[model samples]
Target: MKLSAIAAPHLFIPPEWDREINHIVIDSRDVKQGDLFIARVGRDNHGERFIETAIQAGASAVVALGEPGFRCGILGVPIFSTPDLLDHLSDWLHRAYAGVSQLDLTAVTGTNGKSSVTQYIAQLLTQMKIECGLLGTLGNGIWPNLAETRNTTADLSVVLRHLNDMAEQSIKYAALEVSSHGIDQRRIDGIHFKVAVLTNLTRDHLDYHGSMEAYFEAKRRLFVGGNIGAALINIDDGYGRRLAADKDITVPVFTYGHSDKAEVRYHNVELNARGMTATLTTPWGEADIVLPLIGEFNLANATAAIAVLAIQGFPFESLVAAASTLQSVAGRMEVYVKDNGPLAIVDFAHTPDALDNVLNALKPWNKAISLVFGCGGERDRTKRPIMAVIAQAHAAQVWLTDDNPRGENSDQIFSDVLAADGSDNFYCIHDRRKAIESALEKTDKDGIVVITGKGHEAYQEISGTRHAYSDAGVLIAQGYRKAGEDYVA
Candidate 1:
């Protein structure tokens, strides 16, 4: 495509100038010969400051929201300014890929379970023989061909580009995890969504949203605007219930939960050492589902997926079969076994509500429960105390430890967590690895150890650096194996 064509509505250039442009890049480090560098302003710093870096890397043109701090004219590169460069870039990218009309897009957002549910839906879609694309913490790409991304949700240009790329590869559908920050910043403005799923809302990202209400409002954007055909929500969540109550919703709404009032309700829900089984009562009919994934919370997640797929015109029997064949999402309720002793579950339950749900789901197992978790630094601190209380209330033993205390004192974070649980039943360990080891070492043959927070993540952020860390990796390294497998170490 020509440079003039790419920047059409925003800027005018001749088709001959197309040869002067190579590719579009937001990051200065990735800028190459004849590339158009997009200087987007971020929370920490402005991309304009890196203009020289991009120029030095062979960028022939620059697009920014405002004037570049440096003399771009001297570099002999064209500079373009738009009202909102990111939005313009997104629009431009969307136009570039106008051939992707048959794509079905499903976006799932909430304080937690976004990644897991997105993965679940993607897996089921793939099993149904539909070409699918997945975008979330595990990275964005066609199913089984994921690439690592810096953000849980990609930036506007990257997102559209990925979609276009998938379309070119003949992918029929895509499952995306929409974060509150992504929605609030309008990063998803230009894309059309076939179905939008709201897992639940809780106290999280207060540092960004400033309040719980604002956080919910940010998540509400996914369902309110654009081409969203159906809204799949969790009626058990307060914010979700309110969203369902809103009469202004143009799209059909589908509610899922244990509540009878929900459009897709569950009954006779059972969670045990093996897994979970629930009798799903939907608008179509009633059916029993046995999920390989543990926890009743996961049952809710599964039901949300089922409801969304059903509303999208998938057959109910196919949805149920696809769901029942679904396996556990990595890191969310992941079970690990040892040669002897208790069952260990590593989950991404960082929020208070998530913690409560996971613990409650494991209640009927008749085993001593040991919960190991912590709060992330530079995030919503309001939930730290609540999670501590929940863990203490539900678990036989609560282990409070570090969870990516980025740029915050580990001691201060630990202190705040301990403040929530005043009882002697809790133990504080500043080191996360040590905390997990301690939890496993202390567990008996009839115990259930749950390692929570930072699920599917491969690193731990501390201060300004990200260190290689994985809870599951550490557990496996410490002589832990599948339930019946022998640990060589």
Candidate 2:
């Protein structure tokens, strides 16, 4: 593509540099000849410092916020500066792709359940024989073939590149998990959403967002700002209810929950070892949906997904049937049990509400529940004490271990958790692997051990170092490979 074709008209492009370009990059290491390098502001340092490196790596041109520092010296490339760089980049991307808006896109955002809801939307669509691509923590691809990604929502350049790939593959639908940071940073500014979903909001990321209101406003940008065709919100959540009440949105809004006013509501739900079965009532039609998922929270996720599909014009009965066949998301309520071994569950429940929901959902096992959990360093400190309280209330045994204590003292993090609970059931285990072993050893053969904080995560961080580690991998290595009877599903 010509350089001028992708450049925003308002931004100045050197006449001599208006040549063909192959790609755009944010990281200097990924730059190549014919590539346009972008230096967006970051948390610690401005990307401007990497200009020389991008040049060395063969970046043809440079676009960044503000003027370059004197230390960067003179650049040989066409250097451009703009105070409104992000908005301009968004505009440029929209014009460059052109057909991105034509793809069926669903944007999901909330404190939790974003990954589950996004993946569910993709899976349900694929079951309907629709080619769908997913972008989130689990990875990006068409269903089972998804490749892993570092962030729930990738940066603008990566997202656009992936969207282009999906379009090339003829993917008709795409579901993405939109994070508060992503929205706040304008990572998703360019893309238009066909359906916007608000799973729920709770006390989380206050360390970064400062307050609940600011965090909510970040999420609210998706439903109102983007060219959204429709909105699906979980009214069971206070924040979701508030979002549904907003009449400023010109697009169609659909509410889902157990509330009397919900457009799609479920009643008389039966939850057991196998999963949950609920009688769903929707405006299009009604059906009893069977979800092979473990928690009441998952039932809520399914209801939210149903709303997305229903808005897409699928029959409620077929959505319900196809939903039953959907698989559980990795590391979210994943269960493993072996003959004559303890039952082990691996879940990515790091927040207060998420931890509470996962533990409460395991109530029907009728076995001693031993929980191994920890709080991440440099995160929401308020949730630490609250999680300690929840662990005490639900688990018969609690083991506190290091969960990515990056740049923070492991002992101090453990101390904060210890101060939260006065109970005698808690034990401090600094080693995560040892913590899992202790949880299993302290329980009876029929005992249930649940590992929280890090699920499907392959490493542990301590004092700015990441060591390879996994809760499920350690549990299975400890002779818990056989499927236990408790995992009926």
Question: Highest TM-score among the candidates is held by which one?
Answer: 2
Error of 2 at 238 (Å): 1.2
Q: Which ten residues in a row have the lowest lDDT in candidate 1?
A: 480-489
| CA lDDT, every model vs. true structure | 0.80, 0.83
User: Candidate 1 residues 105-196, lDDT tens each?
Assistant: 89899887787787778778887888678888888898778899888887776787788788878888888999998898776777788889
Model 2 clash tally?
Answer: 4
Q: Which pairs of residues clash in candidate 2, taking residues 3 or more apart in a chain or in different chains?
A: 337-482, 337-483, 337-484, 338-482
Q: After superposition, how far is residue 226 of candidate 1 from its true place, in Å?
A: 3.6
What local lDDT does model 1 show for residue 393?
Answer: 81
What TM-score goes with each of the models?
0.93, 0.94
Which regions of candidate 1 deviate over 4 angstroms? 14-22, 32-34, 67-75, 82-87, 483-489
Clashes of 1: 3
lDDT tens per residue, model 2, 310-353:
89887777788889886778888888876666788899999999
Off by over 4 Å in 2: 67-76, 482-489
Which of the numbered candidates is closest to the native, going by highest lDDT? Answer: 2
